[model samples]
Target: MPISNSSFAFLIISAFLFLSVFQTHGKVIINTNGIGQHSFADMKIDCGKECTRRCQLSSRQNLCRRACGTCCARCNCVPPGTSGNADVCPCYANMTTHGGRKKCP
Candidate 1:
């Protein structure tokens, strides 16, 4: 058996389509776990909800939530717990205030 011109073109086009989908979609699937240079940069999260949860343990809950929200908006990650889990999100962990204090809760 032999392949016809139309069939050959179909295979080539199918391969190209498969390759292009993976090439473009890889970025959308990868680097969304908050552990890369992109670091959840492509993810859409509710900062208000995450910040509220993050600030639950703070004595100054409102202030903590405000700062957490800022950090979450910038970094797109809110650590993992109410406090002291900044290692999980380096961007959130590393952000600093102008006054030389930690910015995120």
Candidate 2:
């Protein structure tokens, strides 16, 4: 038995449609976590003050300040007025370095 040209084209079209739907739809389904509810406009953050206060307790002042600054800017949050309160900002607290260490000071 031999396949006709129309039958071969139908199989190719079906495969292409199946792959396109799954690839695009899968990402939308996986990324629907509610993390995006907090918009930038709703964030009330003082980056400079937050970073300075958070880094003040560290012995590595310069490095601590740099890391704290980066985290504050991105997260728009610093834990509190002092160090060791990372629980206040879950996103900043959960960020990891390339080595799997905590990235923020």
Candidate 3:
């Protein structure tokens, strides 16, 4: 079967649109919630203190604080009382290390 130029262009455009939508699907799921409101409305963090405290047990203080800070900001929830309490925040707890271990400080 022979395809016309216009048909091929249409197919290309359709594929691009499909892929764009697929790539953004995850963001859409994360964004929508009750009343279309953000879940972190009252999110608060003492960045330096939280990071320092969370990373206290780690030998690599700088690395621990950096990664913990990122996870805290992204999850908008940090485990309470720190040190072996990551399970309190599912997202934080589920984060994986580069070597497939738990990464969140």
Candidate 4:
């Protein structure tokens, strides 16, 4: 069967509306400072609060917050919970310190 141009156009518009509503589709967005921008186009995550939660139980809270915040800003993800489970965010997991230690808590 042959489809009309109007039908195709309607389908495209419908798909666009669906995506805009659900935000299943995203666009590249360069940030203000242009550093620590997320690769994904979704709204920015709260790295400060996330780092605070992640570093709450740390012996060195300041150090943990700094590192976790850096990783969260760059990777746009911090592993859930205060300790362990680094596997969830690969970029957060693979980051290393100058001393060859794990960077993110």
lDDT of 2 by residue, 39-103 (tens): 34443578777777777877887888888888878777787766677766767887889999999
The candidate that achieves the highest lDDT relative to the unseen native structure: 4
lDDT of each: 0.78, 0.73, 0.72, 0.81
- Give model 4's TM-score versus the native structure: 0.64
lDDT of 3 by residue, 1-105 (tens): 999999999999999999887665433323332323233344366767888877777899999889888887877766776577755676777778789998787
| RMSD of each candidate relative to the true structure | 6.9, 13.4, 13.8, 5.6
- lDDT preference between candidates 1 and 3, better one: 1
Alpha carbon deviation, residue 60, candidate 1 (Å): 0.8
Candidate 2's C-alpha runs over 4 A off are 1-44
C-alpha lDDT of residue 8 in model 3: 100
lDDT of 1 by residue, 16-96 (tens): 999897676455433454556443234578999988888888899989898888888877778787888777778888788
lDDT of 4: 0.81
Better of 1 and 4 by lDDT: 4
Off by over 4 Å in 3: 1-40
Clashing pairs in 1: none
Ranking by lDDT: 4, 1, 2, 3
